[model samples]
Target chain A: MDNQYIEEAYKEGFTVRFAVKKRLFSEQSEFQKVEIVESTHHGKMLFNDGAAMVSERDEAIYHEMIAHVPLLVHPNPQKVLVIGGGDGGTAREVLRHDSVKECVMVEIDSSVVEGSREFIPKTSCVFTNPRLRLTIGDGVAFMAETKEKFDVILVDSTDPVGPAQPLFGPEFYGNVFRCLNDNGIVVAQGETPFYEPEAQRSLVGIMGKFFAVVRPYNFTNMTYPGGLWSFIFASKGLDPIRDVRVGAEQKLGDFFYYNPDIHRASFSLPTFMRKNLSGLLRDK
Target chain B: MDNQYIEEAYKEGFTVRFAVKKRLFSEQSEFQKVEIVESTHHGKMLFNDGAAMVSERDEAIYHEMIAHVPLLVHPNPQKVLVIGGGDGGTAREVLRHDSVKECVMVEIDSSVVEGSREFIPKTSCVFTNPRLRLTIGDGVAFMAETKEKFDVILVDSTDPVGPAQPLFGPEFYGNVFRCLNDNGIVVAQGETPFYEPEAQRSLVGIMGKFFAVVRPYNFTNMTYPGGLWSFIFASKGLDPIRDVRVGAEQKLGDFFYYNPDIHRASFSLPTFMRKNLSGLLRDK
Candidate 1:
C-alpha cells in the first residue's frame, strides 16, 4: 500500500525510502533508485557497502572525460595518480592508456573502495588490473609527502565537502603541482556550472594562478544533483584540448565511457559558462 | 532526522504532497511544498499544481531554452501556440519576441495556471502581457477543431504520463502538424538522452515522419532528475539548426538562458547522442 517504502538493501543499511518511483535495478544485493518525480539520468544506487548517486548511467562520459583530458595533455605520462575515486572508475580509465606503466589510487575512504569493489562491478574492474596500486590515505596528505612525481594527477574527489573540501584549496593544488613532473597535468571534478558558478569560477581562478594552462570542460551527468556538471584540468605545460589524441588501433571495445568524438565535444562550453570563465579570468 | 516522510495535505479531501519550491513567491502557501537539502547550489522546489519540479533559481534555463529555440528559428513568428505550459514561463519567453503579435496558451488544468500565477510571479508575467491569450482546454482536441495556424508551436508538456501521455502519441503530433503554418517549428520537452534514450528516439522518429527537419537539443537544468535533459524540435519546412538567426539589433540585454552563440552550441551533441540519432535515422 505504501509506495514510498522500499525494501531494498544497501551497503550502509536497508534501502528504505518513503517512495521510489523508478527502480532501474532491484536484485538481491544491489538496487538503483530513480526518484519517480525528479531524477537525473543515472538513478541513485544502493549497493551492499555504500550508496552513490549515478550522475550518468553511461559512466564512460565522466570516466573518459576526467581521466583522458589530463592524460592526453601530459605526453609520456608513465606514472599517474587518482585521488578519492575509491570506486576505481577513474583508475579503470587511467589503465586504458598503454603509455601508462603505473597508476596509484589514493582514496581516503576504504569503505567506499571496498563497497565499490563488491557492488559496482564495472568500476571494480580497475582494481583487478595489475598496473593499479591502491592506497588508503588522505589524497591531500599523500600528495604532500610523495617525492615520487606523477606525469598526471587526477583528484576525483566527491562534492566539495567532507574530505574533498581541502582538495579545492590553493594549498592542495600547490602540493599537486609539486608532486607532478614539470609537464604534468592535474584534473579535478568541478561542481555543476548551473548550480555552483561561483565555486567553479573560484576554483578556476585559483588553478589559473598555479598552472599555466587552466581549462574547464563541460560534461552532462544526469545522476548528479544538477543536470550539467564541469571538470577543470590544470596543467603545467600542454593544452589538453589541443594535444588530445586517440589511437585508431587502441582497444575501444573495453571502453563504455570515453572515445575520440567525446574528447572534442566535452570541451565545448555554453554561453553562460563561457561568460563566467571570461569574467573570472578578467577579475584575475 | 527522517527525511523520507513526505507530508500530505488534504485540500477539500484531495490528498496532495506539499511540494513548495518556487522562488518568485515570498510566503509558503498551502499549494506549494519545499524540499531542503545539503545542496551546494540553489535549493530545489516542486510546484504541486502543475506537478512540475522547479528549482527556486534555475527555471530560467529550462524556460529560455524551450522558448527561444523555436522562436529564433522562425523568421517572422507572429502567432504562437504553447500547449500544456501552465507555469507561463514559456509564454513569458514567447511574449519577449517583438515579432510575436499573438500568443495563445491551452492548458488542461486551470488550477495549474492559477497556482503558477499566484506563486511563480516572474513566470506569470507573460499572462499579463497584452499580446497573450490564455485558454483552458484539452490542447489536442483544440488543435483538431481550430483552423488557426501558428508560426511556432511549443509543446511544453510534462513527461509522457497521466494526461500528457496523449501528447506524445501519433494523433497529437498529427494535430500539431496541421496546427502549424508553412515554415512553422515545434519544440517539445523530450526526456533525458541518458535515462530515456528510447523516449527521445520515439519522439524524434514520430516527428521526423511528419516534419521535413527534426533535431534534438539539450540543456542543463540541475533541478531535473538528470543533470542533462533533451528537447526535440520538429519543423514543417525549415531546419531548426540552419534556420536560427538572432539579429544584432534585436538582441536584448543580458539573457541568462539563451543567446545566439549558445543557439549554435546547444546543437553540438556528444558522440553517444550523435550515434543514437544516426542509428534512429538509419532505422527509419
Candidate 2:
C-alpha cells in the first residue's frame, strides 16, 4: 500500500497526494462525502468533499492556532462560538481556555461529526466536554437568529465550496458581526492565498468592510493545498497585537504549535502576500 | 501528461508528488544524478539524485530568503560567495543588490551548472553577469584554499546526502568561517527540522560553537517534505534581526517572497521549534 496514494485535486491543475495505509471508512452524507483514511505520512485523516480537513499528526497546529489567537486577544472571553467545526478539534482547543464558560459549535453537517468521532477520534473526542453544546444546523442561520453574543467566533468551515460556500459570503460575515459583543473577535479559516487567491481575497475584502481591526496570518498546514494556509481575524474593538498576551493556560500543556511568539510571528506576511494585501487593502 | 505525476521519496516513509508535463533532461553526472522536468503545477523543476531542489514557481522564496537576508544584514555587501547553488537562482538573487561588485559561485558539479544553464535558463542566466565568476569544483576544497574573503556566503546546497554530505561537517564550516571577512555572514540550507530534527539540531549546534550569533529560521517550501524547511544563519559580528534592513534593491522589483517584516518575523520560531531550540541551546 506504500505506492497506493490518495490524491486531492485542490486547485484546477494542482494536487497533493498522501500514501494511504488503509481506508477506515467512506460514505456520502446528506451534505457531503466523508472519509477516514490512515495515511503513511499523516496519521488518521478526515476528508469532507474529498478535501483533507484534519490529520492526527499536525492537527494541533491548525486547532491551536485558530482557537488561541483570538481567545488570547480578548482580555476576558467568557462565551465563545464555533461554526462549521464538525470535527470537534476547534471545540477541544476552545475548552483549553479556563475563561470560557460555554462553547457552542454549530455544524451544518451531522455526519461529519459522526464520522470524525468514529474514525478520527483523537480530535473528535471533544464532544464529551461538559461546556460544549453541539448544534447541528446551518452556521449562518444559527448566528443570524441567536440572541446571545460571543467574545470569539471561530468559523472553521471547509474551503469555500459546496456546503461551505455560503460561509464565505457577506451575509455570513454580517451574521457573525451581529452575533459578537463590542470588543468581540471573529477568526475564520481563510483559504490558501497562493492556491485559492479568489477565496482569500474575497474573504479578506468582505471582512475588512465590517471589522475595525482586520488582520490575516498564516501557518504551514501540510494537509492543505499549497502547504501555506491563511486565517483572518476581524475584531470589533480589540486589537490582536496589543490586546493579546501569553495566557497561563496556553503555556501549560497539549498545544504543540501555538505559543506567544508564534501568535505574533504569524502576522508577518511574505512579500507575495504583502503585495496581494497591499493592493487588496488599498482598494478597500 | 495531466495524469502523469512524478513523486520524490523525501524521507523513509514520506513522499511529495508533482504533476509532470514533460521530462526536460536526465543524466548521471560525476557528482550526482541530475534531472530537469517541467511540471504542470510548478513551472520548471530541478532534481538531484531523485530529490527535488527547485521549482520555477516558488524558487524565488528559497533564493530570496537565502541571499537577501544576509546581503541586507551587511552594511555594504560588495563581495558575495555562493557555494553549491548550481541552479544559479542564488546568484541571480544576489546580483539584485546594487552594492555587489563581485558574485563568485563555487559549485561542486559542473554538470549541474551546465544542465541548469541549458534547461533552467530563466534562473541560470546570471552566468552572463560581468561580475559573476562560476567556479566548477569541490566547494569544500575551494573554500579551504581561497584567500578571498566575502561579505556574505550563501550555501544553497541540496540535502546533506551523497555528494553534499561533506558540506555539512565542521571542517567545511570552519573553511566557510575563515573565508568570510570580519563582519561576515553565512546562511546555509539547514534541512527540515520537523522531518530532519537531527540534521537541524546538529547544524545549529556546530555553528553555535564557531559563530558569535547563530539563528535558525524556517519557511514553507511546498516541494519539500514536512512543508516546514529550516535555514541557519551564522554571523561573526552582525545580528540578522538587529542589522538587516529592507534595502532599496529588495523593494525595487522581482522579489516575491521576502520583506522587512518577514525578515524580523522569520526569526520568531514556533512553540514546537522553540522547545527543540530551547533545550538544544541549553545543552550546548
Candidate 3:
C-alpha cells in the first residue's frame, strides 16, 4: 500500500485517474492483463487489458442493469447462460430470481475468477451457488457448438478487442441465435454511445442480421468513458416494453440502479443517438 | 499550452485530466477564476474556479435539458429570466422560442460575460440577440428586490460555493416564489445525486417549501464528477409531464439531447437515488 495512481485514457486527451492505496493483484492472464487494486473512492477496482472492468462502488449499476433488464422481460427465465462474466456478478443477479432453476457461466480466463474470489468477494460470492455450473473455456466456441437451449443468454464480455473480439463478430451472434429458445433474449455490453458510436452502430448492425428485435439502452457508469454506457438487447420477437411482466420487477428485492421505471426510461435515446444509430436500431 | 494538462479532482481520490492545446483566456474575475482553454477532445472548454463549466462538444446536453424542460411545460412563456448564466447558453435556448418576447440575464461577474463572448461564441452568441437584456449584478440581490414577474426562471449558477452560495438558500427561493406568476416554473442546477446526495437532498428540501411541485431530473454529462448530473424543477402548479403542451417539442428546430421521449425519461430515478432522496423528492 502506497501513494499510487492508475489513469485510464478514455480518449486522446481525456483521462480518469484513480488514487490506488495498494495493488492487491496483477497478472498477465492467458486472455488479457487482469489487475485488481484497492482504491480510495471505489474500494476494489478491476482492470482487464487496462480497461476498467468493475469497481466496488458502482458495480451494481452495470451488473444489475445487465442481468435484471433481460431477466425481468423474459416470461419464464427458468434457465440462463452467462458468457465471459468471470467476475460472477452477473450470475449473482441471475440466481436471485426464484424461477431460475439452473445457471451456467463460461469464462475464458480463470485468473479473473480467482482474483474476484479473493479480492472482490462482493460479486464473486456467487461461486458457491448450487444452481450455477461454472465452465472454464471460450464463450464463442461454446455458443457455436452447444445444442442446449437457454431462456436467456447474458453476454458479459469485455470491449470488442483481444479475446472478446470474436464475441462481437457475426458468426458468434449467429451461434447465439441458435442456442436460445423461441422466446429467449440476449443482452450484451454495448460500448459507450457518446465515445464509441461507430463500434456501437456496427455491433447493432451485425445483431440486426439475425434477431427480429434489437434495441440499445443506456445507463450512467461512473468509471466508464463519457459517464454513459449502453447495452444491446436482441430478442427473437419479445418487446422489452410491451411484453414486460406485470409484477415481475417487484419480485426482485432491491437494487442500486435497475428499477421498473428505469427499465423503460433507459430505452429513451437522446436525439443525437437516434440520428447516429438510425437504421441500426430495429425498434426504431 | 504545448504539453499542458489540467486536472480536476472531483473527490479526494478521483480526478479527470484534460490535455490542453492552448489557453484561450484566463482571468481572475471579481467572483471566481474563469479560464477558457482549447482542449483536444472537448474542443473549447470553460472552467469556473477549476471546475468544468461548459465544453463545445457536450454543451447542448446541459443547456438544452435546463431551458427546454421548463419552457415547454409553461403554456406561454412570453417573459423569461435567467440568473447567473454569463455564458449565454441558457439564454440562447430560452430565446429560441418565438413566444418569448424578452429575456433578462443577471450575472454577477462581468468578466465571465466578456471572456465567453470573445472565446466561446457557440454558447455566448446570444449576447447580440435583441430580445435579451443583459445586466451585470448579483442574482440573489436582484431576486429579493425586483417586482417584475416571469413565467420561467432558470437558475444556472455555478456550484454552491463562492458567490453562488446564496442562490441555494431558503431566503432566495422564498423571494423567487413571490416574484413568479401563478403557474410559473423554476428550474435550478441540482448537484449530482451520486456524489453530492446531501446537497441534493437539502436543496430539494428548500425548494419544497416554496413550490407545489419539486422534482429532480438527471442527465449524463461527460466532464462532471459522476458523469451524472441533476436539476431541480419547481413549479407553482404546472406539472412537467401532465401540463406539457401537445406538439410543443416539434416546434423545437433540432436538438442534441432534449426531446419528447427524453423529457419524460429524465425524471425516472434509480433505486438508490429514490431511497436516499425519499422525503425530499416531491413526486415520490
Candidate 4:
C-alpha cells in the first residue's frame, strides 16, 4: 500500500497515523483550515487544522451518540439546535427523529460544509434537507440573540485546545440553557476522560451549575484520540437514565451504535471519572 | 526527539506508534519473543512476539480491572489460579485481597518472567510474594492433569490471533470448568469488542455452554488496540453484578480505574455489543 498523504494525530503522549489515499479538498476556512482526504481504510475523512473530525467509516459512532442520546431522553423534541457540526453528520442524526420539526445547525465556518458536500457526499446530504436551517455565524451569538427555544441542544464542536475552547465554557452553556425549552436537554461531545482528564472533569462541573441534572455519557469511537469518547448531557427535567422513552430504538433507523441499553449504560462512569466529576457535581 | 526503537502497532485499520528510549532486555522464550523496552512517556514497556503486553505507565488500568473485578464478585476467594500472566501484574493484584491465601500463576515461558524482573521491577515485585506459587509449564496441560480446584480462575493471556488462540477455545474452557470448584468463578481477558467482533461473540457463545453466568465487562486501556477492552466472567454460583461485595474498593489500595460502580457498569454492554452477545447468551 503506497500512501501519499499521512496525518499524524498526537494525543496523550502517542502518535497515531491515518493513511490518506488522496487529498480531496483543502481550504483555509474562517474558523480553521478544513481538509477532506480520502483514505483506503477509514474511507473519506474530514480534518480541521490537521486534526480528525469525521470519517466516512466511523463517523456514525460519533454522530449517533451525540444526536440520539439527548433526543431519546426528551419526550417530544419539536425544535433542536446543533452548534459547530459543520460536516452535517450531527444535523443528519437530529432529523432522524419524527417529532423534531426543525433542526438549526450553527456552524462557524461554511467551508467545512462545502468540503463535506464536495468530498464526503453521503453524510453531507442532510445539509440540503428542507427541515434543517443552516446558519453561517457564531453559535454563541446565535444562542444569545435567537428567541426561538429548542427542546434539545447538541454541541458538536472540535477539541477545546483552540477555537472550540469557548464552546466548552460556562458562558456558552449559559447561552445554550437560555435557547432551550424549560424541560430541554443539552449534550456536547466531551473529550475522552482517559486523554483529557481535567477538561472532562471541568466541563461536567460547569454544566452542573446551570442545569439541575448534569450527567456525562461515554461511547467507543475508534477514529477518535483514545477510542473512548464522551458526551456530557445536562437536563432540566429529564434524567438521561430514567426518562429515556421505551421503544425509541424502534423509531430510529439503521444505527451503528445508540440504543436504549447503551443510553442507560453510558451513564455508568468508571471509578476515576466518578471521582473526578462527583466532587465537582457536589460543589454546588 | 532522538529515539532508538519505534514500534508501529497495526490493529483494525489504524496504526499507533510508540517511541522507545532504550532496550532494557531481550530473550527468545520457548513460547514467544520476550522484549522489554523503556519508553519515553509510557515508562518501561513489555512486548511479547512483537505485540504489547503491558506498559509501566497504564499497566494499573489493565491489571486492576482484570484481577479485582472477579475477585470482588466472589465473597471469599481463598485459592486463585492465574493462567499465562507472565508479567506478574496479575499476581500482584490478586495478592492485594486479605482473604485470598494463595495465588498460583502458570506461565509457559520462563524467559517472560525472567525479562520482567530484569526490566519492569515495580510491577514485577509480586514474583517474590510468598503467597504466590509460580509454575512454569503449559497451562493447558496443567489444567487438564492437575486435580487441584481453584475458587477463582483467571486467564490473562495475549491476543487470540496466535498462540493464545487455544486458550480461548471451548476445549480449554472445559478444562477450566473441571479445574474450578462447584461454586467457582472464571474470568478471562476477552479481546477488544470494538476491534474483534466475531471473536468476542464466539468466545461468549463458547463459554455459555459451560457456565450458567457468562458476562463481559469493558475497560479503557490506552496502549491496547482499541482503547476499550473486555474481560469475560463465567461463573457457576455467583452473578458478577448481583454478588459483588460491597466496600470492595475500600478494601483495596488506590486504584486507577476499577471500582464498585465500574464493576456493575462494566457489564452494561454497548447496543451493538449487547446485540452480539445477547444472541449468544440466549442460545443456551
Candidate 5:
C-alpha cells in the first residue's frame, strides 16, 4: 500500500500535513470520530474529530506541562480529578505524583479510551495503574453533579466544539469552582493565542469571575494549528508562581519539558497576548 | 481563478501549506531563489529557496527578539552589525534603539533586498534610515575582512544548507569574536531544537569555545518547520540574563513581543534541550 498523507486545515489558508505509514484503525464514535494511525513524523497518533490529540513523539510536552504545573503549585494534592482525558496521557502524568492517593478520570467517549489503550501504549499504559479509576461518562454532567472536591482538576478536552463546547463557558467553570478546595487549582487547555485570541479571552474572563488567580501560560505544540498553545491556570487563593515549592520538580523523575525553571517561565506571556488578555488575567 | 496553495515540506514527513492570493514576484537570484507571494494567512510573505523567510503578520516576533535581547544585554550598543537580514526587518528593529550610532547590514543577495523593498515595504521601509548602511556581499567575507569593531553582532542567516552554509561553521564565529569589543555580544539564529538538535548542539559547542558565556534560547515561529526556533547568545564576558539592564525595554516605545520578562524566560530551555546540550552551555 502506498503511504498516505493526512492534511489538517487549521483555517482557510494554513494547514499541516503528516505522512502516515499506515492507518491502523478508524471509527465514528458516539462523541466524535476517533482515529489511530502510525505516522512517520509523530509516531502512533490518535485523532478526535479530525483534530490531532496525542502522539507518542510529542505527547510528553503537552501532558507533562498540564499535570506537573498544577501538581507543583498545590502543597499536597492527595486527590485529583481529570475530565475528558480518554487517551490516558493526563492520567499517566497525574499518577506520577506520589501525593495523589486516587485519580478519577471521567472520559465521555469509550472509543477514545479503547483506541488509545491499544494503539498508543506509551501514554495509555497508565490506564492499568492501581491509583487510577476510569469512568466512561460525560465530563460536563459529572462535573455538575459530583459532590466530591479535588485539589487539582485537569480539563483535558478537545477544542471548544461539539462535545467540548460546554467546557469553555461560565456554567462549567462555576461548577468547577464549587467542587474545588480552598487552595485548589484547575488547568485547562485554552486554545492557541495566535488564531484563537477571542476564545482565550472569553475562557480567561469566565474563569476570572470564579477564581481569585487566573493566568494563562504557554507551551509549543507542533501538531496544533498555530504551534503555540496556552493552558489557563485558575486557583481559589494560591498563586501558581509564589505557591510553587522551589525544589518540587526534582521529585518528578524524568520530564521531557516541565521543570522548575520552565514552570515559572511559562507564565511569561508575549506582549501581544498580554495586551489582548489585559483585563482577563488576574495575576494577583 | 482558483486559489493556489504553496507547500514547503520541512522534512520527508512534515509540511506546511500557505494559500497564495497572487504570486507577486519570482526569480532565480544569483545566490538563491527569491519569491514573493501575497498569503492569506501571513500577509505578504518572502520565501528564499522555497523557505518562508518573513511574513508581515509574524515578523515582529522574530525580528524584535533577535534585535532587542542582545541590545538590552549590552549596556550601550552604539555600533551594531546584522548579517543576511536582506528583508530589512532586523535593521528596522536594530534602529529602534536611539543609542545605535551606526547599523551595518551585510546581505549577500540583492534580489532579496529589491523584491522585499517592492513587495514587503512594511519591513523594507527601514532601508531609508540614515543610521543603517546596507552592503551587498558575502557575509562570511565581510566578517573576515571588516576592520571596524561592533558592540553587538546579529547573524540572521538562513538554514544551514545552500549558500548560507558557511555562516554556521567555526570560521565565521572566530571572525565575529575578533570583531567584537570587550563586552560585545553575538546572537545567531541557531535553528529549531525539535528538528535540529544536532545543529543546536554543534552551534552551542562551537560558540562555547569562543565566548565566556554561550547559551541558546527559544522562540516560537509558526512559519518555521517545528513551530519552535532558537537563537544562540554568545558573549566575551557578559551574561545575557544578569547583565541585562533592568527596565531598559521601556525605552523602546512599542513592541509586539520583546520585553524584559520574555528576555529572561526565553533562556529557560526544556528538559530535553538541557540534557542534550549539557556541558556545552556555559552559564557563568
Candidate 6:
C-alpha cells in the first residue's frame, strides 16, 4: 500500500498509535481551553481545557487497575469518593459493585468530564448511573468541606501538576485520611516504577505519614512507555492486603478485571522495585 | 489540524488495523501469516504477516513463569526444550538456572530470530550463549522425530491460529506428554481469561486429557486490550507449584520480572475466573 493510503488508515484512528506527540482539544463551550503540549516518556498527554483527561495511551490500565483493586479489597463497600476521575472510568467500575450506595465524584475540570462523556463513551457510563453525585469543583476543597466519610476513597488524579500537584502532597493525603471511615482504604496511581521512582518514593513517603499502613504494588501494561506501572494503597487503620479476605468460598461475579488472587499478586514486586523500596515501610 | 495533517501521524508497515477494508499487508511472505479474523468475542483481525515477529506481549512474565515453575519443582533439571520462541527471550531466562546444562529452541521463523536479534536487542542476547542450541523447523514435527526426552518442555507459541493452532490441539499435546521425561512438566500460554474463555477451556481440556496435572495461571499486563491474561502449566508427573522451592537461602539477581514468591501467588485464581473454570478439572 502507498504512504497516502496508510496515512488515511492512520487518520481514521482505527489503529491507536502508541506514540509521543502534543495533543490539543479546543474548547467548544463555556469551559476551559484544552491544550496539551508536554512530552513524557509515556504516551502523549490528553488535555481538555488545560487539564489531563487521560494520557492518550496509558489511560485504560491505570484507570482499570486503580479502580478494581480497592473495590475488590473491601467487602460490602457502599459509600465511595472519587477525588479526580474526570474521565469517569473509575466511577463506572465503582458503581458496578452492587453494594455501592453512592459515589461522590469531585472532578476539578467540568470540561474534562463533559468532553470525556462525549469522546469516550466506555468511560462515561458512570455519569448515567443514578447513584453517582457529580460535583464540578476543586477535589481537595470539596474533601475539606465534606465530613461524610466514605468506605473507599479513590484518588484518580493525573500526575501532580497544575490542580493535581496538591493531591499528592502531605495535606491532601491527611484530608483523605480524615475523609475515610475506619474500614476504608484508598488506592492511587502512584507513577511509573521505571521513569518516576522518586515520585513514587515521595508519594509513598507522605502517605506513610498520614496512614497507619501503606502498600505498593506493580502491574504490567504495554501501552505505557516503560511497560510497568505501580499503585499505592493507603488505609487509615487497616492493613490493605491483610484486610482483604476473598477465598474459594466467596461468591463473586464474572469480572474481566480484578479478583483476590490478583489482589495478592499485585503486591509482589520485582527485584529492581525491591531495591528502590529498600528502607521504606509503613507499618505504624 | 487539517485531514492531511492528521493523516501524517499514521506510520505504515507495523500498524495493524481491525477493520477488513484497512489491512496494509495482504500478500504472504516467506514467513507465516497468522490472522485472528474472528474469535468467539476478541477483536476482529485484519491479516497479519507471519514474517513479523509474533510474540506473546508479556514475554517476560510468560517466559519466567513457565520455565521457573517446573524447573523449581523438579529436584534437578538438566535438559529443556523450548518450542516456537524465535526471539530467544525464553531461552535467556531458562539459562539463569544453574542446574540446567542443555537447552534447545525450535523456532519456525529464522527471520524472526534474526530480526529480533537486530531490533529487540535485549531479548536477542540469549541466542549467543553456547548452552543454547537453535533448531529451525516445525516444533511439532521436531518433537515427534526425537527419541530424546526433556526434563521440561515449554510451548511458547503465538496465539492459537495458523501454524500454532495445532499446538493447542490434543494430538500435539499427546506428543508433548511423550517427549517429556518421567516427572517432567510442560507449560503454554492459555488465551485471555476475560475475552476468550472458550480458547482457555479448550486448551485446558486438551492438556487435562494428556497430562496427570493441569492448572491455569494468570498475570495482568496493561499494554494488551484487556488488563489480565492467563497461562496453563501441565505436568506428567509432579505438581509444578507444590514441588518448587525458593527461600532466603537462594541468591537472586537483577530480575525485572519473576521471583519465587510470585510463583505461588500466580496460581491463585480470582473469583470470576474460578467461576468460569468451575468443573473443568478432572481426577488425576
Please report how far candidate 2 places residue A213 from its true position, in Å: 1.5
Residue A101 displacement in candidate 1 (angstroms): 1.7
* lDDT string, candidate 3, B1-70, tens digits: 1258876777758888889989899899888999999998898888898899998999999999999999
Cα-based lDDT for every prediction: 0.69, 0.83, 0.91, 0.83, 0.91, 0.67
The weakest ten consecutive residues by lDDT in model 4 chain B span: B1-10
Candidate 2 residue B216 Cα shift, in angstroms, is 0.6
Positional deviation of residue A207's Cα in model 1 after best superposition, in angstroms = 0.5
Error at B238, model 4, angstroms: 2.3
Considering TM-score, which of the candidate structures 3 and 4 is the better prediction for this target? 3
Q: Total clashes, candidate 1?
A: 26
Please tell me how candidate 3 rates in CAPRI terms: high
State the DockQ, from 0 to 1, for candidate 1: 0.25
Model 3 lDDT tens row, A150-226: 99999999988899999889999999899999998999999988888888998899999999999999999889878
Please list the residue runs of candidate 6 whose C-alpha ends up more than 4 Å from where it truly belongs after superposition. Answer: A1-15, A18-79, A86-102, A112-132, A144-151, A181-184, A191-198, A218-229, A245-254, B1-29, B32-62, B115-121, B191-198, B220-229, B269-278, B281-284
A266: Cα error in model 2, Å: 0.8
Worst 10 residues of 6 chain B by lDDT: B4-13
Per-residue alpha-carbon lDDT of model 5 for A1-284, expressed as tens digits? Answer: 13587767778588778899999889998889898999997899888877889878889999999999999989999999999989999999999999999999999999999998888899899988999999999988999999999999999989999999999999999999999998899999989888888999999999999998999999996788778899999999889899898887787799998888889899999999999998778866
Cα lDDT for residue B117, model 6?
Answer: 64
Candidate with more favorable, higher TM-score: 1 or 2: 2
Name the runs in model 2 displaced over 4 angstroms.
A1-3, A246-254, A282-284, B1-3, B246-254, B279-284
DockQ of each: 0.25, 0.61, 0.85, 0.59, 0.79, 0.19
List per-model TM-scores for chain B.
0.82, 0.94, 0.97, 0.95, 0.98, 0.80
Give a tens-digit lDDT track for model 4, residues A67-173: 88888879999999999998889999999998989999898889998999888877898978999999988887887788888999999999996678888898888
Clashes of each: 26, 0, 0, 0, 0, 8
- Candidate 2 lDDT over A31-90, as tens digits, reads 888888898878988888778898888898899989988988888888999998899999
Tell me which residue pairs clash in candidate 3: none
lDDT: worst 10-residue window of model 6 chain A: A3-12
lDDT of 6 by residue, A188-220 (tens): 878777557788888988888877878897765
Which DockQ value does candidate 2 get? 0.61
Candidate 1 lDDT score at position B91: 91
lDDT of 4 by residue, B1-284 (tens): 23554454565356666777788888886667888888878889888877778988789888888889888988889999999998899989999998999999999889888888888887789988999999999888888898998999999989886667788898999999998887799989988777788888889889889998888888877787767789888898688877888887696878877777677777777767777776565211
